[model samples]
Target: MAMTIALNKAGKRFNRDWIFRNLTFQFESGNSYAIIGSNGSGKSTFLQVISGAYHLNEGHCTWTDGATLPVEKVYRHIAYCAPYLELIEEMTLLEFLEFHQHFKPFVAGMTPKKIIEEIGMQAAAHKRIQQFSSGMKQRAKLAQCIYSDVPVLLLDEPCTNLDRQGIDLYYTLIDQYAKNRLVLVGSNDEVEYKFCTQRLNIMDYKSF
Candidate 1:
């Protein structure tokens, strides 16, 4: 089934300040898009809004897979990874992936063992997340999202804690998993979103 996300005059505000307003766009499955903006711009917020994580302050956003899907159910169809999203520090690498499978099954043919091997964290599979380095934690986050069987993938500052090798791993994961999915990346770095065919600058939609 084809998934589609439509934002109709969407806007978000904190108190009296509008982050972005009257923004309208549609995202269809099988295409990748980049949401670029300055650090203070609403790139991440917009991604969250479309991912059904945050409610729009004005107007609305909707999800469709042949037919409109309920907003509450949208999360099941999305795999989101962001710098601000925290992993369970108490769970071991293997345990976390096993637990995640209960809620969201991995993409076809992806198992917990495959994920740990692909992320190059096989040695630390039994180690708790809290003991992992920042880069390792970031790898785990990306692994979870990338390997999930979801139609929509939202990535915000995906390479935040990654080093050169870690960045390379990110690209490899995306190259293998992002096909035929709605992949939206929020970042100003070209390398992070080079695969995206479309770009949206949040600043362009801002209204003073």
Candidate 2:
């Protein structure tokens, strides 16, 4: 079944200042979209709106997959990765993966070990995440975010701590795992969203 995330006249404000207002858009499954903007331009907030992490102040948002899905159940269908979202540093890479599976299953035939191996972090699988390097931590984040079996994938600054090799790996994972899903990348860097066919520049939607 096809899925869609629709917003109608949506608006949000913080401290009497509207970040974005009077926006209407529908995001369909099987397509990739880029939310481009400078830092503090509400790109993250906009993604959260679509992800049902935040509510609209003026309009409405809805998700539909054959039928409308309640907001409470939206998290089950979405996999989100953001720079600000922290992992449980106390858990090992493998332990974290095992813990996450209790909430969201990985892609079919994927085990925690396999996932760590796919990211080339098999050697550190048993090491606590707090011991991982910045790039390594980012890889762990991407492994969990991209490998999850979910229809909606939301990424914010996905390549933040990645190097050239890590960036290549990111694209590879996106190309292989993101087929036929709703992928939204929040970033201003072209490299981060180069594969996205559709683009929404946040500056264009900043109507107060």
Candidate 3:
């Protein structure tokens, strides 16, 4: 099924500060979107609202696949990754992916061992995540989130600590795996979201 997400007059705020308001948009399966804005412009907050991490102060966000998905179960269909989101540092690369599968299984034919290999992290598979370099840690995070079998993928600064080669691997995964899914990226760097088909600039809805 092609999943769809709709936001009608969506508004979110903290105290008197409005992030974005009166914004209506739709995100459909098989397309990728970029949430564009300068620093501190609420890009991440907006994505979180759709991820069910925050509630809109006003308006509504809906998920559908022919029928409207219930608020309580919407999370089951989405996979998210972010720079600040912590991983199980104590777990080895092999162990982390195995642990992830218990909650969100990887795509069919994909195993924990396969995911580690996919990210070229086989050399670090037996080491603890905390012992990894910044680039390696980011690769592990991406492996767990991107390799999961889901329709919607939300990435906030996905290439945070990646180097030149690591960045190339990101696009490789997207090309090979995310073609049919709904991918949303929050970033100002065009390189980070160059593959997205749509763009939402939060400044268009920002209020003082």
lDDT of 3 at 157: 90
Candidate 3 root-mean-square deviation in Å: 0.8
Error of 1 at 5 (Å): 0.4
Q: Residue by residue across 62-164, what tens digits does model 1's lDDT show?
A: 8999889998999999999998999999999999999999999998898999899988999999999999999999999999999989999999989998999
Collision pairs in model 1: none
Task: Flag clash pairs in model 2.
Answer: none
lDDT agreement with native, every candidate: 0.93, 0.91, 0.92
lDDT of 2 by residue, 85-129 (tens): 999999999999999999999988999989888889889989999
TM agreement with the true structure for every prediction: 0.98, 0.98, 0.98
Model 1 scores a TM of: 0.98
Which candidate gets the maximum lDDT versus the true structure?
1
* Clashes per model (N, Cα, C within 3 A): 0, 0, 0
Query: lDDT (0-100) at residue 25 of candidate 2?
Result: 90
